[model samples]
Target: MTHTRRDVFLGLGAVGLLGACANGVGGRGGATIDARVDATLAQLYRDYPATRQLADKSAGLLVMPLVTEAGLGFGGGGGNGALRIGGATVDYYNMVKASGGLQIGVQQYSHVLFFMTDDALQTFRRSGGFAAGAGIAYATPQKGEALAAETTTSLAPVIAVIFGQSGLRVGATLEGVKYTRIIP
Candidate 1:
């Protein structure tokens, strides 16, 4: 395909506009993020009651209230969240991701990471920026269905529950997502 400078600028401009539309970006502040986190958790527990058990068993939970993602050819996403231990907020974090491929869409979703083991929670807390890797297990539940927190998931150090997705995008995965602690 032939490339023009105009095409490049338009793509970049579109991405910038998408970033602005994302939730919890552009200095929304700690209180705003906390509110969203609480609401997200409430919705999660309501949708999948089984997750409450997981939350209780988890060493810590990182709740991302909303992540906004969009792409034409290249894409990126960002969101703010809170880390909770024993039902209390301990820290705030921001999640970000970037990708380039044959993709085009915009989507919004919420995800929570369950640190099943103290080691996993410590590893995440100690890191300057933590990226999701192979060690993490994903549990995506369909609407009105229970999360299958089986023996395998119990043994996994970290479990991720992704839900409340809405948009033109097809799927959501944390494969390349990175989490960093933020003051806000």
Candidate 2:
């Protein structure tokens, strides 16, 4: 058998798409997504008490309970989640990512975005797809310590907290995530 570079790329793309879909990107409607959101929030607040304040102050929240990513040279990932406004599920969203760089390995992680202003939440909801930007502040947790919302996070309209990572990936960063609203 002879496989060209294009053939390999096509095969990888198909496998990545299938892997994303199989992760239940929009599988069971809002129920499963909301459940995961609730559990994720509970765990987050319990583990990082400092984040509860951010949640309380934020106008909305987008919680992606689990996103699985894998790659040898190219990589992709997807996950289902819920957006909460006023602490209630207002919409469902799916996150997808793709990247090509010096990367390899598989990983799973949870991420939550706190929309600190109504304007920010509205902009995200109205967009066809929202991508995390430089303005977004990240509250990355460290070992044996609660992540505190920095002054920069308070100034930014959107704050992202990524935690509960389990994988063998060398470095993890949500640099190219594209989030879109989903019916499920």
Candidate 3:
């Protein structure tokens, strides 16, 4: 099989489409991922109710706008999420530089993570400034979102806001992707 640049993108596109088949939840195996998203969001609201107040705080920092990329390379699953710190929603494709292995297949998932504290929130404020060290639990889920619980590198004044992603599977380290705000 001669895989040229075109073939590479074609494979990526196919995987991406399969992942996009669902709205990030309630599709095929999406039930699990969606359920996780909902539980996490509810817990986030309870844990960091203040984030609602700080939603307008994030700015200048990396804005990772929600993006849907179709790829058939290694992993095939589309999930959308937004993380707001200092009034700016910092999430999207280019914002979070991803660098890790991948898994490809037809799947759908959704999730949102809030940095529940001031220091942790600030860490991400810098352009590509998430001091994620080795074994620094990158992605986790609630119920199935992430049993490890929220990892607060430091206790800074902050809150977490998660919504509509109750069931999803996030690799220990899914790289190069981020969550950007969506202004309606």
Predicted structure with the largest TM-score when compared to the true one:
1
Best by lDDT: 1
What's every prediction's RMSD, in angstroms? Answer: 2.9, 3.7, 9.2
Candidate 1 stretches greater than 4 Å from native: 1-11, 22-28, 170-175
Q: How many backbone clashes can be found in candidate 2?
A: 0
Which candidate, 2 or 3, has the higher lDDT? 2
**Residue by residue across 1-184, what tens digits does model 2's lDDT show?**
3445864585387446646465444457677778789999999998888888888888999999998877645667778898999888988888877755545677888999999889999999999999887778887786457666656356689999899999886544334889998886
Q: Tell how far residue 4 is off in model 3, in angstroms.
A: 4.4
lDDT of 1 by residue, 1-184 (tens): 3435654565476568766764554576878888999999999999999999889888999999988877655567888899999999999998887755555688888999999999999999999999997798888899998775555355589999999999996443323789999886
Q: TM-score, each model? A: 0.87, 0.86, 0.39
All models: lDDT? Answer: 0.83, 0.79, 0.37
Count of clashing pairs, candidate 1:
0
Worst 10 residues of 1 by lDDT: 1-10
Candidate with better TM-score, 2 vs 3: 2
